[model samples]
Target: MKLDIQHETHYEYSAPLRYSTQSLRLTPQPSAHQTVLRWALQVPGKLFAQRDGYGNEAHTWTLARRLWRGAIHAAGLVETHASPWLVDAPALPSPLLYLRPTALTPFDRQLLNIGAQALDGAPAERNLLALARLVRERVAYRHGVTDVMTSAVDALDIGAGVCQDQAHVFIAACRARGVPARYVSGYFYAPDSPALASHAWADVCIDIPGRLWLSVDVTHGCVMDDRHVRLAVGPDYAACLPIRGVRHGGGEEAMRVSVQIRPAAP
Candidate 1:
C-alpha cells in the first residue's frame, strides 16, 4: 500500500520570538515494513540534517528571522509493505540498550508491579501483546485528559489518556519486565478516517532466537501493519518529538496540528 501524508503544525505567539531552534524528527524510516519514495520538511529557516543515535533522520531548523508565528509542515509519499510484527536484524547494537527508563516513561514500582504480574508466565512472542492489553485495560483511551508532559505512571493513575500515553505506558512496562522497549512516533492510515492520521506505538525488542522488534499498538489492540508508517524511535516522546524547540520570547503560545493520510492514487 502507498500513502500520501501531509502533516502541519502551527505555533502562534502573542509576541514575536527573538531566536529559536527546533529539532524535527519527521523523516520516515524505510524498513522491512515500509519504503520512502519521496519526503520533505518545510519550515521557516535553513535546516541542518543529521542522524540520531537511534538511526532516525533528524533535522535542526534555526530561525532566520523574527516571527510572531511559525509553522512546520512535512509532505511525503511512502510505499508500505505487509510486514509482520517482527523487525528483523534491527541496526541497534543490542536490545538491552533500551532498558533504561526516561522521565516520561519511568519503569517505577507501580509499572514494575504491573509488568511482573502480566509477564510472569508469558512467552516472548506474546509478551508485547500482554503488555499492550495491560495498557489499554488500565488506561482508557480518553484524549484531553493528558498532555505531552504526562508520564506513564501518571496516565495509569488518571486511568485516561491518548495514544502517546498508551505508548509510554507500554514502553515503561516492557522495560520493567526486562524486555528492551522504545517509543515510536509515526502516522497511521485509516482509509475511511483520513482525519485521524498522526499515531504512536510501542516497540519491544524480543531477544528470542531470531531477535525481532515487535510493534504493538496499544490503542488499536493489535500489532501494526502496512498502515503504520515509521517516523522516529526514542526512549520517549521527549527525544523524538515531531516539533520541539527553545525560544527566547513567546508569550501565550497556541499550537494547532493538522494531518491528512490517505492511500495514494494508482
Candidate 2:
C-alpha cells in the first residue's frame, strides 16, 4: 500500500518575533515495513536536513527575521510494504538503551506489579499485547485532560487521556516489567476520521524466541499496519515530537494542525 500524506501546521502570534526556529521530525525513517519514495518539507523559511540521534531524518527550520504568522508543511509519499507479523526488527544497537526511566515515563510500583501479574507466565510478545489491551480498556480516550507535562502515572490516575497518554502508560508499564519500550509518533490513515491522522503509539523490544520490536497501538489495542506511517521513535514523545520549536518575542501564541493521509492513485 502507498499513502500520500499532508501534515500542515500554522502558528499565529499576536506580535511579531525577532526569529523562530523549529526542528522537524516530519520525515519517516527507513524500516523493514516501509520505504520513503519521495518527501519534502514546506516552510516559511529555510530547511536543512539533519539526522537525529535515533537515526530518524529530521529537518531544521529557521525564520531568522521578524515573523508573526507562519506555516510549516510536510508533504510526502511513502509506500508501505508492511508485514502482519507482530515483530519489527530495526537495526538498533540494543533494546536495553530504551529502558531508562524518564520524567514522562517513570516506572511505578503499582504499574510494574500489574505488568508482572498480567504476564502470568505468558511470553513477552503475548504479555505486551495483553498489557496494551488492558491499558486501552483502563484509560478512556479523551482529549484536553492532559498535556505534555502529564506523566504516565498521572494519566493512569485520571483514567482518561489522548493517544500520547496511552502510549506513555503502555511504555511505562512495559518498562516497569523490564521490557524495553520506545515511543512512536506517526499518522494513522483513517479515511473516515481525520482526527486519527496524527497519532501516537508505543513499541516494545521483546526477546522470547528472538529479539524484535513490536509496534502496539494501546489506544486501539492492535498491532500497527500499513495505515500507520511512522515519523519518529525515541524513549518518549519529547524526543520524537513532530515539531519542537523555540520562539522569541511572541506573546500568547496559538497553534493549529491538519493532517491528511489518503491512498495514492495508481
> Which candidate wins on lDDT?
1
Task: Evaluate candidate 1 by giving its C-alpha RMSD to the native, one decimal.
Answer: 2.1
lDDT of 1: 0.84
Q: State in Å the error of residue 265, model 2.
A: 1.4
Please give each candidate's TM-score. Answer: 0.92, 0.92
Question: What TM-score does model 2 achieve against the real structure?
Answer: 0.92
Tens digits of lDDT, candidate 1, 17-116: 8788999999997788888999999999998999888777899988846689988999999998867465545565466778898999986898988788
Q: Name the regions of candidate 2 deviating beyond 4 angstroms.
A: 84-93, 120-123, 208-211
Note each model's CA RMSD in angstroms.
2.1, 2.2
Candidates' C-alpha lDDT: 0.84, 0.82
Looking at candidate 2, the ten consecutive residues that score lowest on lDDT are 84-93
User: What lDDT tens digits, residue by residue, belong to model 2 across residues 68-128?
Assistant: 8888888999988764233434554467878888999997986786577665653355667
The numbered model that scores best in TM-score is 2
- Clashing residue pairs in candidate 2 are none
